[model samples]
Target: MRFFDRTCLSSLLGASLVAGSLAATPVLARQPDGPVDLTAQAQPAKPAPTKPAPATPAPKPSTPAPSAAAPSPLAVPSTSATPVVEEPDTLPVAHWTLADAQSLLATIRGIGAEGLFARDYEPANLAAAIKVGEGDALDQLASRLFVWLAEDLRDGRTPMTARVQWFAVDPDQDNHPNAQLLAQATETHDIKGVLAGLSPKHPDYALLKDMLSKTKDPKQIAMIRANMDRWRWLGQDLGLQYLIINVPEQELRLTVNNQIIRTYRAIVGKPGRTATPQLAEQVRNVVFNPTWTVPQSIVVGEGLGARLIGNPRQAAREGYVATKNADGTITVVQQPGENNALGRVKLDMPNEHAIYIHDTPSRQLFAQPQRALSHGCIRAERATELAMTMAILGADLPPETAVEYNLSGKYTKVPMTKPWAVYITYFTVARDVNGVMRSFADLYGRDPAVIASFAKPRELHTSQRKSNEAVIKLDNPL
Candidate 1:
């Protein structure tokens, strides 16, 4: 009996050891610690969750939140009056005829209802897209299809986005998603199309969906659409693996395999300034104990700008100090540590704007419903693992050692063993989800330019995009 017990114990111990070993591997996913994943990432101090917001009181209609400007109600086009062109005779298609394609947009424009760009013409475009059999025309149709589906939720006539104004109108149903669009998406197998209609559960999903939907140039859309693809293709394209921060919708999705596996809230450069320029770049290295170099603009323009003069020591006390140059232009940088503005780690992605992804000590900001607040660089919630993930996705370096290197205060490149494809893109729409359309703030007002860029009576084409032709890789590669 003792011998039997010993053998059983040994078998259990062996099984436990195997499980532990598997958990240690990066391939295995551990439960997210409700914050950053330190076991597989870095030594990130978890931000405590804030108190639940007070139940939204019955809101006043004319009054917008004093913190920001209130946007007007979205104008949903009246499609109830219009009739769907019954094409019951036609089979679901992979392409659209040029006539069908032209008619999609042409008829809408001819109707003089510009507001119907996303909804009124979408079905037509989808039908037209299916009619196109070959070349870039098909690709253009796909892009348009992506854009329309994505935008309707965010920027188009479809109510894909959450409207704060709705609270004043329909308090009960405002928070409860009106599954008006979602029901339609459920009928399709197009994951991208459905995702394009994502709701408040993921607001940026709608914006990116729309951004993809409005593309006239297939080449551009195809590059950015990989993030929305139903397939996973990573490491096949070895190019500059830079950081991408899309500011308009406040969410940050880190991409590898041309897919977004990591996403979080980012506090971009305040819309009040051109400080955090909308752009993309390669992260040269990370600085653990980073020093914040205050820009001349902040010192010269802010109300407390001259505070560094009489009480320079006060600045240092708050983990900030002024770096005086011979030219008399002083730069204020925050010190690294608990008090540091950039919490612990900063992913250094190079671009025209000295903007990079960084951890913020102000975890309270994450709780805010509309988190479009930031000085310049992106203040990423759950940034520690994101930075660590960036290093691991492209480079083989252990996250611990990377943090140590940053703590050393020495700037160094987290080498990329495999290329990380980071695409910094903006679109008002997408089609990744259940047919719900999503929309967002036209942060740069790039919509008009985007609309103008649509192909001018261009022929429908579908040349296979070389960038998208890469072989799909498996998470557990065989």
Candidate 2:
């Protein structure tokens, strides 16, 4: 299969693009009240250090800190000062000992176990530099190679061009800075251990690695490798509690302490322009008995507004409130009711995509095997239960209060005392809800680019953390 169009490949092979620096802005925490404001929040600036902090040894991968606050929006720059190096000379060289150089060469040579090619790091060149007996040449070559390997392990091996519609900003680099890792590796001479620490902390990566070792078929190995790399694209530690939705699997999982607490069937965006984009967002509020403001595309283009304006009785019966403006435009809102587009609850996670998870009035849609049915947003099955659970877990709301809010048939927004991370991910090869390893159909045909990237030489990591595609706000649940 053709992985990329000519235009896309041309852009990928062209000069690396430098991402502009983002000015940090303060974000004010909002109280749970009316509808959620989906504005993007900037990451606050960190204070400069007066002296270099002691380099702490890398810790073993454990459950992520439960109380850590959600990260800033995808557009927000990483707090880590790790430079995106386009060339070997771009990075600062660190003094390398002969022993450390030997260890690094061995680590690079055996990188294939992590689905990375050692040749990409120029292992031969590093070995030759080591033969010349530890000098600036050896230090410079080893440092550059180490940075490249660390970047691939921490961020991902796939270039931005191959990752279609992906907006999830990985925070691994911030957690494990490349320069810091390089220094730590040289100081401790534990080259392998330091680099190995960069692997994604998620269990799925380990499982995929195991599968890769056992699988004999070339195709299956490629699939496993691609999925393994997908894990690296996300944050190393995916918090103590989070919600993960696998779009192709049509599954939503509520995981706590690396175990699945609950699973919900999900109806994701339809394939094509409305196909759901991968995202990493935080659920800030839970809206019970939510209202739906009809978009102009539906109100005008679909003639719903004109019809509602002409038939007031019908509009009222359908739970629609219509108003005619002086500008000859009509406004339409589907009031909170059983027939409302957003069934009983909505998880408010503000981002530029305007995508949210909400209850669906059409419960039968969940039963269909092919659930790529919505415009863009996720239509969750048993949404009231999900919302109640989120309210109790995130907002510390009493179960009774949550039920009351759901049954009250009135709008209520419960702000999260502790916002939970919500990941809308697309994985063609992954464990099903029942914990069975299997492959789902690539509903959006996204796997080819990633699989193809694995076959080609590794590309330099760029400043771009996400796809540069224009943000398409598809709010309509239908």
Candidate 3:
């Protein structure tokens, strides 16, 4: 068995390993400890109180004059009689000609090439409608089927419920509205071309589709189909330049113009609750020689606060500054130094979860093949190099200036001139750093849910964008 398989088996057999002990007290930092308890049972310390800001006064409402327009309870409202106007971009179903309907039928038959089921679009009903000729019956059914097909292609066949910990909001629905697509298809009479355009713009989507065509094994086909839909879960176009971290593979790809420019080994969150949630955020700034703020879980719960409160010498030696707040609460901040937990740099991407990519003092951890070790945040290997590259590319900082900042050993945050995107994604199967197509162990076991979703009939899209799971803000890089 592989290392990941052995580790996963051991974790399963030992419940304590899979889920940290709830009764165990928090411990102070030495080197990085085992996975931190991030479940709801682990209560975080209450934040210190601050004075409330002054509220703005509400304006008084204007009184309306008494009118003699009171209607009886049985009376129909005048506005209810008005005809509903279709949006300017909405193509009338009655306007769809036989040629256009036939073209859509042809596209529906071959949607399986794009990893979609032809039966899901009600192809037989569409064919019957087409046979009857263009009328209300034909128009309504054709239009409805077209819209459904368009939605599945643009958004995804899988519903939100099956996407475990998915938080990336797809903007394609708004950018290419159903009505607008229908209008364009009918106007140009290029139903196949218009529908094909809805596929994800990412190169991986095309690769997956090509693979699906050549593969014959049932399991491989299902896996390819599941991953193909996974691409649809994200935005159609991941920006021109961005950082995409695949959590399962424990690798980060720096992509430029749909091409992989660089790859870095990464240490992702451990299994269970500390497993990193999927996210798409902007890298606003890169901080060099970053400080680490010790959470109260460590400072107070673990007795680190009491130990360092009066021992300035010990605290200085550890590169930490401990202060007792006015509220009798203890605050601990690790200063910038060689001993700092965040080694030398961190990419500041603001999000609800407080997850970010940063350097680690324990670089040896990256040498391990199965690197599901961090609390939740990502630890990038050779992170200083990654940081300096980001500084030059995203912030337009000169190489010498970046070098100076790194050597200065002071916390310096350089803002990006044009913010680049950072996508924290989970893929069980994808191209590895060496550009070889392979499968990684599902460390978090998220693949089953997606694969199961593919077995059922397609579900309707919902308003929910991200996972409804509570955002656990344990920012401990350890």
Candidate 4:
């Protein structure tokens, strides 16, 4: 029975081999020499390959799709980190024509209402030029009109032709600015606006103009007129910050952008030969515990040399250092101390005249109403306060540094970070702290000349006006 079962199994295996060989024949024919294991499971037979159904033509649209490979039309460039540079301020331009000449003439005549000399603008000349109509005459007149407007707008008047002898620190009166003003006036047809823009912005000037327009008192009018002309002496713009000492008022005002920051009582030069000359200078440095090198005139005229000669020991005790020269001339110097003539501080403003602003040992002098007692240099009442204020405003000397040097009580000079511009001026009439116009004593007798200038016939040309200065040889010291 086992032999019969073995024979049947062999016959069944033979039949299975024949079927597997037939199934793998197509695959083996396509890939000859490929591995074919009989033990591996046979994969299901694939159907006969048929041609893919023809792809339906994509429905044609009105607008064709954009090509993905091409650059986009709305692309923006990457932003840069660099800052953009800005252009400088452009000057205003003028836009006046021949038709605007009459308006300009009317505006010119109204300058008198601004406390300015109207005739100086040559209104009659402008009128005549306008009457002549077209050509070079009208062109010249138009040119002159714009130029005058620009000049008056920037600097009240021509100081040189006005016969103002005092040094005018008017850096704003440069030709470039005048040219710009001319351009502006020619570009703008607003005659009244232009005229209004030209006047001094100071409250005092406006106040004087108001008083002159209404007041009838001759003396009062004359005083106001003289003061008006005095405004012409200074630059149109004083500065963002400056020190102005009114000699007649005996007051020193620290002004920033025309507004008074602080007012200080001051002791100015006496009248006549010792009068403080009106000047514009820069405060270069502040010296603490300053020494006084006595002027020759003071040493000899005050009999200080004689005292030193008679009692050298006494002179030494009083801080005087006397040196008798080979020529028998005496040089005197006071050492830095509390009793020094310059007191505890001195502001150095180097000028040809050797002028300075300093402190004084005599604080009582400030209490007096008329405080004109110095030789030439201004004596500030609260000098230490002034020094501290300057140190703060300029930031040249730190508070600690100022305090250290001030308390040290030693002769030391501290240069200003930014030199403060100082104007030692003499104005008999000016506005007070309350904005009320006040008249001061004409300590230097200088009002007559300034006042006389108003009465003098207006010269045809500014150059024709003579210098009012009278050169006099005097025995008195400067």
Candidate 5:
């Protein structure tokens, strides 16, 4: 199977703009309701080194090896010829460290999110999104967006101990970004110069809200503030199509172009023992007729009873096939088929947590608002269709190949030709679902700090707001 990835975001900070007095100018940039301050240092993009491709010429055909001296007597035969340096594995790669991801997140000190928010693109966020085609840069960009779409509660299920998702946009390129960027760019460029110009009074939303209120380094703050603007101000207003879950509300929503398409009840993981960790990754593929592997924790713990009672026939009953390893340790694996615990499909978003999104036979659980009952993974309602949608993201996929799993047990590999992104987001502001504003049980308890950020007293606009962070309040408390 071939795999690739991409994001829907691009840089949005335009040339310096003036405050106020706006005329419909190039890419109408909307005036920010208030000043955007910068306290934390900006995260500068570092150029990555590229590996030069080897210049080896094609090898000429060789005569067959002699019988006695063939390779080696005890040498293990390579399972694969010209073995790839990267071992064949089922795990997803996580390149960003936790700290690297946290820098993009926001704190309660401000109203704006720290990383790229939908508001940045203003009038053009959606338009600009369209400009980003199926390129490698776009995939990296989308991966970054994944960080914002999904949250990592540090629950045992997912490996993102620090990174988190905040929004629920579509997992497809159905929406455009270039258009959105144009709309926002027009809004800001029209008011160049008069605007407060990213200052302490502006209170840059990156780092914590009080970053400027605490630090007093202008040079440090200036550069940091600049990137912060680019990151925060410019965003896809008609956000990407994604699956958003509000941890604070215990809700799940699928969105398309800012409009929510579906809402469902979800159970989050309990805090500590298996906190629902904030994570950002894409659903690369979906597994059909999936089987549940009782985690080691379960196998070694309470599940042993069920394993003993169920292990013998667990393969057939649970729709799995059992096999003992050379070490005599029994293992049960499930293949794609009806009656499979995974329902019909499962999304593959590799993270430290073996957590994944899959169809759940237990549809009733979705009705419950506090649905954090799984070991750590998410049991999605209508997950089979969701998988189908992922397959559809791969435009080249023959419609039959995309849905073939429903017809048979064959594993389907659909490469994203147009680039589809899946985000397990977590934003609790509500409004997107178009349903009555609902709150959720904080099963993972991610709100206290974020909620506290709102309640924390303010510090008078401090020189520190400029760049260097010392952790002080900005603006005198009311």
Candidate 6:
């Protein structure tokens, strides 16, 4: 089976606005009190500018005899001079003593406690690297382990292993300079503490770690491991406010300040070729009562074109408009209505896959326990509510306006006043509504790839891992 990646399509489709032939200026959601005028205010207007009165001339001073009682200006403290106060060093530093190295080595040996394989950190080799009285080797070992610890903490096994189309954003892209970590390790002499500092502090990460500690079933443990690693695939920070869709669970959540404010049931792409890919995009706007431009694959593959040609009356009855091209091909479009595939509203987030979050007439599908039943695009259960929420949160629209405005039969677009980040991801395990950790079905079969990646042997020592890091490329001197 072939997979259609949408990361590239996002760039191409993003260049053009989704207005179609509609006006560039979308009708703004009406404010209850109408537009504000900067001219009017409760405070009185400023007084008119007045010319200053002519300045009085100063009388010349007469020379006076020196008086011993008069104080000199030099006797006062100099205001221009700034006192330098030495600041105490507050930064954590590493103290790479034999004891410190052994402490870190203990954590490395117990890596399995963190839902990771202990073998991945090379126990035997690390044991050999941290010899007592070998100061140079101990220091080198500390640096190497620090680099490995940082990579595992920041990115989790390589991205390619998970087959995710991820791009570094925000905190993920922020460089974690090894030199700084190494220098701090040298000063603080707390190798274990320094390594712990590198781990992600997100609550979900902590929850998974807690779950890992108690989980005994190998299958469940593996699932948790996969999910934990998936978090590392995403950037360290998910932004102040963003939307995340879990394809496997068929759910969408609007998170603000790390709290989930709203959760909506979603219909994700079907398994196999139509599976939704893991990616990151930004929701730019909402299209109300949008027209569906049927893809040619659907037209020809589904025999829609031939059916329309055989019975022209069906086109009008189904709200389909067929346009014959110069090349003799026909293009079919479904008008906005209750029967429209994209229901009454659609969230606009351009991507190579031509996927978006939108309303769907097939609301009954949401009632099913398993909701993997879409053709790439996500069909939201509470599309109108989600749209209205987005309008108030990102489009600067009043709640009343978002709720009261009627779509009727028009194709209206509401551009976001401020775009919201949206991430499409896949995970086999996560916390449910009741906060109970649960495992989900691998609808797209992504778990195996992630699980396999974790199975790959890690670089034995920190120096080898750092030297082979993709973030650090050594160019040919030629």
Q: Which parts of model 3 have CA positions greater than 4 angstroms off?
A: 1-94
Model 6 bad stretches (over 4 Å): 1-103, 132-135, 162-190, 301-317, 404-408, 459-478
- Cα lDDT computed for each candidate against the true fold: 0.40, 0.75, 0.74, 0.60, 0.36, 0.59
- What C-alpha lDDT, on a 0 to 100 scale, does residue 170 get in candidate 1? 14
What does candidate 4's lDDT look like per residue over 1-478, in tens digits?
Answer: 0111333323422332223221111111111111222112212332121222222222112211111111212222323232232222322334346667787777766666655444555566666666767565555545554555555555544333333335544454553364565655556756566556755666667766666766555565666667776675566556667889988888887776666655778888776666676677888888888888787777898888878966878988999888898999898888887788888888888776667888888888888877878776788867876776576456455555666777776899877888588888766677654444567777777666555545542222122222345432221112
lDDT of 2 by residue, 1-478 (tens): 0122334433322321112121122222322111111111112232121121122222111211101122212222323333343433257468999998898888877776787666566665667778889777777777877887898898988888788999999988787887789889888888889999888877778866766656655566677778888998999899978999998888787776677666788999999999999999999999998999999999989999989998889999999999999998999999998888998889999999999999988998887778889998998877876787788778888655766787788999999998599999987767665454667888898887787767654666767889988888885787
Candidate 4 has what TM-score? 0.70
**Cα displacement (Å) at residue 88, model 2:** 8.6
Candidate 6, residues 1-478, lDDT tens digits: the string is: 0111233222212322222221222222322111122112212332221222222221111211111122212132322232232212222224477677777668766666555554444445456656445565455545555555655766575334245433323244245665676676657776667667666655777877876666555555566777887777677777777888887777787776676655777888777556676667888887877888887777787888878865668897988988778998888888888888788888998765567888887788888777777767788877876776677667877544554443346787889988698888876676554344556677776676566545443422112111111221111000
Residue 74's lDDT within candidate 4 is 23
Any runs in candidate 2 off by more than 4 Å, and if so which?
1-89
lDDT of 1 by residue, 167-190 (tens): 111111222222433333333434
Q: What is the alpha-carbon lDDT for the whole of candidate 5? A: 0.36
- Clash number for candidate 1: 62
Across 196-241, the per-residue lDDT of candidate 5 in tens digits comes to 1221121122233234234344333222322233222122231355
Residue 126 CA error for candidate 5 (Å)?
Answer: 36
Candidate 5 stretches greater than 4 Å from native:
1-239, 300-318, 410-413, 435-441, 454-478
| Model 6 / residue 384 / CA error / Å | 0.6
Span of ten consecutive residues with least summed lDDT in model 6: 469-478
Q: Total clashing residue pairs per candidate?
A: 62, 0, 0, 9, 110, 16
TM-score of each model, paired residue for residue: 0.44, 0.81, 0.80, 0.70, 0.45, 0.69
Winner on TM-score (1 vs 6): 6
Ordering by TM-score: 2, 3, 4, 6, 5, 1
